[model samples]
Target: MNQQLPLLFPNAISLTIKREDLIHPFVSGNKFRKLKYNLLQAETQQYKTLLTFGGAFSNHIAAVAYAGKEKGFKTIGIIRGDELGSKISENPTLSFAENCGMQLEFISREEYRLKSELSFIENLKAKFGDFYLIPEGGTNALAIKGCQEILTPEDAEFDYICCSIGTGGTISGIINSALPHQKVLGFPALKGDFLKEEIRSFVNKENWELLTDYHFGGYGKVNEVLIGFINSFYQKNKIPLDPIYTGKMVFGVIDLIQKNFFPAQSKILLIHTGGIQGIQGMNMKLRNKKLPIIEIND
Candidate 1:
């Protein structure tokens, strides 16, 4: 569902959010899109188990856990940060995955980088037996295929479609489906320009642009100001945004609106590609630092 933002801008620019987050309580938004066809393919091949990679507080990890359980496939999460193994009970995301029946294997960040290599996957196959491997961030070809369905016929009216970028899979799909007159803007959650190549591999269009200014210090890094913006944005909009992805994208859109970066009367659609599950984990970190926290972590 798409809901218009209540804010009035000087340029008469309008903001509307595509509430993909409401698609599911657990496996919501882009996670749902990315996993949809992959899960179908797994069953088509008769795979009994699903395997994926993520970090301690990864929304992907949490979503896969619940989605696997719901779909009746055993799930394994190879998480980054070996130290997180002992602290699973204290971490909201990891604990949720565990409770959802996901077997968690914590590994060093160095080893995590070898995730795309064939030797590492062969070793995993030897240890865990056969399983359907979903890449880290769930950004494979099938996942991109799933993401292409995010836009519908009604979305053609919007001048700009914006979303947060993680592995570039989601935006790649948007870029593929967006009308030629529409520009898709991606706000990367991490600090890097390599995403251009990642997105380029999946899409052939040049209508998308990555706005890198609103990361707020890389993936999983958040400050009091961001937390405050999230809190207030929620209070006014009754929309919950996770700190890592959607929040930053929304912030960038509004900032651009204020700066007159868009022409008057431009209609923008912001894709809320669900990471609300990570809010609790982020709030835990905010409390540890005595920073201002988001109002809606539930």
Candidate 2:
């Protein structure tokens, strides 16, 4: 469905959202896209086990776990932050993954940083005995190939395609599939322009740009302003957005509208890459900090 948000955009401009979040309850949006080809490749390779990495409340972790279970593949999640090992019961994402039969193994943050290194992967292969390894954020070539299917011929009507950036995989696909007349805009959930190089590595197109000023601190960081915007947007649009990714992108898109970033009468399509699963874990942090929690309908 193309959901228009006239209230959020300037009078002459049109803003609509592609509800990719509604694609599936668990493996929604880019997670589903990122995993589709990966899972198929694993099956083709006759790999019975799927292994990936993530943080305490990574959407990728939860998606991979459930996808593996549904596909009849044993799953393993190499989690960052060894402290999270004993606290799985307290984390909604980790707990959900565990409930889906994903084996949870926690390692130090330092070790997590070497996840892409050959030696670390070799160590994991030796320890786990040969599994299909999906990198954190699920941004491999197959993942990008899956994400490329997000935009269809119907989407050609839009002048701009906007999406939240996590590992740059989703936006890369959008950039690749976007019409030549459309400019794809990405709002990074993290604070940096480094993703430009990462995204460029995946696509041959130059029709996209990153909005770096709206991260609201960085990945996994949120404040009252962002929280309020998300809550209010949900109340108005009846569309719940996760604070980490979609919420920040929506916030930036609206702010840019107010700032006159787009030309008058521009048609914008915002890709709602799913991350709602992280809200429960994020709410836990908010409650602990005595901050306002993001409100979502049951």
Model 1, C-alpha of 80: deviation from truth (Å): 0.5
lDDT of 1 by residue, 37-126 (tens): 999999999999999999978889999999999999999999999998899989989999999999999999999999999999999999
Taken over the whole model, the C-alpha lDDT of each candidate is 0.93, 0.92
Best by lDDT: 1
Off by over 4 Å in 1: none
TM-score of 2: 0.98
TM-score of candidate 1 against the unseen true structure = 0.98
TM-score for all models, in order of appearance: 0.98, 0.98
Query: On residues 103-195, what C-alpha lDDT tens digit does candidate 2 reach at each position?
Result: 999999999999999999999999999999898999989999999999999998899999999999999888888889999999999987999
Clashes of each: 0, 0
Give me the displacement of residue 58 in model 1, in angstroms. Answer: 0.8
Model 1's number of clashes is 0
